[model samples]
Target chain A: MDIIVSQLMTGLSIASILMLVALGLAVIYGVTGVINLAHGEFVMLGAYAAWALQTEFGMGLLASLVPIFIIMAAVGWLVEVLVISRLYDRLLDTILATWGIGVMAQQAVRLAAGGELRYVQMPEPLSKSVTILGATDSAYRLFILFVALALFAVTWVIYRHTNFGLKLRAITQNRAVASSYGINASRIYRLTFAYGAGLAGLAGALVSPLKSVSPEMGTNYVVDAFMVVVLGGTQSLMGTLASSGILGELSGYLAFYSNDTIAKALVLLAIVVLIRFRPQGLFTARVRT
Target chain B: MSGKTKTEIVICAAVCLAILLVPVFMNDSFLLNKYARYLVLGMLAIALSLSWGYAGILNLGQATTFGLGSYCMAMALKLKTIPIHTGPDGLPDFMVWNNVPELPWFWKPFYSTTFGVTAGIVIPLLFAALLGWFMFRGRVTGVYAAITTLAAMVVVQLVIIDQQAYTGGFNGITDLAQFDVAGFAFDAYGSASYYLVAICLTASLFLALAVTKSKAGLIVQAIRDQEDRVRFFGYDVALYKIFIFSVSGAIAGLAGMLYTIVMEFASPTFMGVPLSLSVVIWVAVGGRQSLVGAMLGALIVAGMQGALSESETFLDSWTLVMGLLFVLVVLFLPKGIAGAVETITARFERRDPAPAQQPQRTDAAGAGTHHLESLP
Candidate 1:
């Protein structure tokens, strides 16, 4: 029983990270209608940026987050203006183009930082494990859960109440109609893309402490996030969150009993089956083409 | 044939001959070896083009099929290497270590090269057929199909990695012996292996071309362009899709056999997602929808990677360049290099006056009169 409780906590922590990553992917796909295969690369860049700041400048983990987020957000904006903007309205091309961008980013990082795994040092507070309900849990894992909740709240507020969010919703529903209403679709796309990318950057920062920081580390999470998006239904934040939690918990429990690889494969197979049965995903969006 | 088509055919033949003669002029055994690797890659690309270019099935799990083929060949080689019931536990060395008493029943037939080759093609095809039937029969298309195949790739990779006793885990299978065709010994590392690979590639290409020109190929292309319309016409869209997918899988398997022969090793990386994605890039860069374009694309990309990897200056940035090229090609040339070439040549020919137009028009009309002369 204690083991089950501890495993559930671990699952929640993983769900937190999955939610962060999948949220960014969902938002980007919602507004731009682009799958953004480089979304994982953005997370990777964020992790690397944080790693560089800590190793090179000796900055604290919290202090490194802000700068890394800004840098990654800027990169995202530049990518939107330069490459992604040209591939709009063509989903296949967008998928291919962003995949190329992903490869380029991954290879660039690989060239800079050989294929070795680098560790990130957590703060003293997060370094300790906390005892809860007769079970010990990593403080860092608990912290990630809190951070994820806070981030989710912040994203929800921004998406629902903010003017930018309003414009984004407008653009996503009908681009031509939104433009006719005098909303600059391109401006919204750029800002939302950067915002989504910033969230991915934040996700990378969050997961860096838990997992080894490496150029190809993002490869592990990319497919899972895509699965999350598909399972949740594209462009639905609620759906993303719901699916992430379900998958994270399912995979964690499976991993607890079985091997990690089998757990992952089972989750993937589940997603395929779910998509086959319910193409619109678990949570259907009201807006349609 | 008209003088223009006849000229095009002659030019294509000349190019093929030039490629064949590359080993004659290149004194370096290393260069010849590299070209041989490219030829094997070309076979895989040809398979990619048939399924993706013509059928619009963006199969990103092609490496899964390729790996299946290679593993079959490797298993046969492994079986040959082990002595018959000499070990402590009458089992293959790796299986014994993993605690299996005897060879897996499925792997038993792979002791024969002929059976191994057949299984290599048949297994992937059977898998693809089942998968295509489930997905396409239900009218799944576009991104859904892509995701399904991608998932299959992940599943296959995980399975391969976990079944370490049988598969050698991440280390994969190695030390495969030279293939014995009838009574002739074809060494894996020497010129004989290269020649074997070349012959396999050429034969695979010809078979792929033949399949692409068949009636079933036409139905597959029709399904690609208009699935609903094809269904309305009383055609079994799922059957056609499965057939083409199976053929493509077989070709990929054949390519895998050649790949193992040339590289003399097989591992999980050979069937990983990255290799699958690379096959997509090969088809795209070569000009999807054109067999010849796919062949050239694979040759050029694989050949360039080999050459560039050798140079210190190009090593670091080669992947970046390849990625950029992928993006550029997808954006600028949607039909790929072959389509671009045809478009360019047609434009140039349009600019020039036609000396013999009436006969060509008559021939075109006559060809059009046929319900289906050849598959696209």
Candidate 2:
């Protein structure tokens, strides 16, 4: 009973990370119809940002979150204006182009920061253990679980009631119609893209203490995030949230039963089968062809 | 052949001539060997172009087939070096290290050269056909196909790594002997290896050219450009996709075999996402729709990568340079380096534009990739 409860905690925590990574990707794909391959790099940059803040400037982890979000948001905006904006009409080219950006971002980080893995020191306050259901686990994992929930709630509020969200939804429904109604679709996209990027940064900041920070960290996250976005209908936030939960828990349970590598392979096989059956995604979005 | 096709062939012949003269001009055996290796990679680029550029199927897992081919050859070579092929306890050294008391079941057939050679090519082809059936049968095309291939690649790579006892795990199959065909031995260090690679490259190039320029090739291109229209015309779209995909896999497998011969080892790095992405970029940078362009693109890009990464000063920054180049090429030069070459040559020759630019430039299928998904 204790082991099962612990595994559930692990599954939920992993699910949170998956949802965090996919949040940005789902938003961008939903609004702009651009599958931004560089979404992973944005998360990577956020981790580096936290490392720099903690190591170089002596800022606390929570304190650096806002700055990292702002910096990464600006970077995301620049990417939109310079590269992604031009190739909006070409799906494959955007994929290739964004992939190029992803590579550049990775290399740029490597060249600037050096290739060695950097650690983000966990704050002293949360460095203790907590017990629940007769199981002992680190407080940091519980902290991460809370942060993930907070992020989801924050994202939901932003999408549900804000003017930016309204414009984003209008644009998604019909860009031309939205423009005629005096909503600048371009501005909405730029801001939304940046916002999405900021969410990725936030996720990175939250998860930095748990994993080693490196230039290639984004690549792994991006692959998982892509799977999550696809498995959930790409256009539906609720679907993204649910699918991430399903996959994260599935892998978590499988890993406990077997090994990590076998669990990963089985997950991939499951995803491939899933995509084959429902190419559009888990939930069908109502849209005009 | 048409004049444009003839020009493409002539340019490829010139590249072959340059490679052929390397041993004569440069006494450096290392450089000569590197050039041979690049030629083999160039074959891979052509295979990518055949499926991606010509058939409009972006098979991101092209490297998987190539790596499988390399493993096939490496397994055969590893078996030959052993004193015996049978007995449960007579395992390869690595398996012995892993405490396997017997030879694994899969490693048995590789003891025969014929089986190895045939299996190397056919396995990838069959694999592609099976994958294509799953993908195209479900009407998965474009970005969907790309994602599926990428996922499949990760799965295959993980499996290879996990089964370390049988596959030698991450170290992969190594310490291979010079490749032999029946009784004929091709020495790795000698000129025989170079000639072997050169001949295979030339044969593969011709084979690709023949396929792309044939009547069936035109239909395949048509399918890429106008899938719905072609389907309306009463053709099996999935059949065309599967055929081209399988052919591409065969070529990639052959390239893998040559890679094993030249490099004397096979590793999972060859089948991973990064290398696979580089192959796509090479084809895109070379001019995706042109075979000769794709081959030259791989050769040039790989050659530069080698020189840059090897030099002490640029070693750290070469990957950054490559990424920047990739982005710039994707954005401003969508037609690629080869496209520029083709345009310039066409202008110099001042050929009849009417014949060159036929009226069949169907505007519908020419969207850069896809303008947009349906709006909600």
* Candidate that would win on DockQ: 2
lDDT score of model 2?
0.85
Relative to the true structure, candidate 1 reaches a TM of 0.91
TM-score of chain B taken alone, candidate 1: 0.87
Output per-candidate TM-scores for chain A, rounded to 2 decimals.
0.96, 0.96
Scored by TM against the true chain B, the candidates give 0.87, 0.89
| Residue range A9-61, candidate 1, lDDT tens digits | 87887788888888888888877888788989999988888788889999878
Taken over the whole model, the C-alpha lDDT of each candidate is 0.81, 0.85
Off by over 4 Å in 2: A285-289, B84-90, B347-376
Interface RMSD of 2: 0.9
- Worst lDDT 10-window in candidate 1 chain A: A280-289
Residue A167 displacement in candidate 1 (angstroms): 3.0
Candidate 1 to native Cα RMSD, angstroms = 4.6
* Local lDDT at B61 for model 2: 88
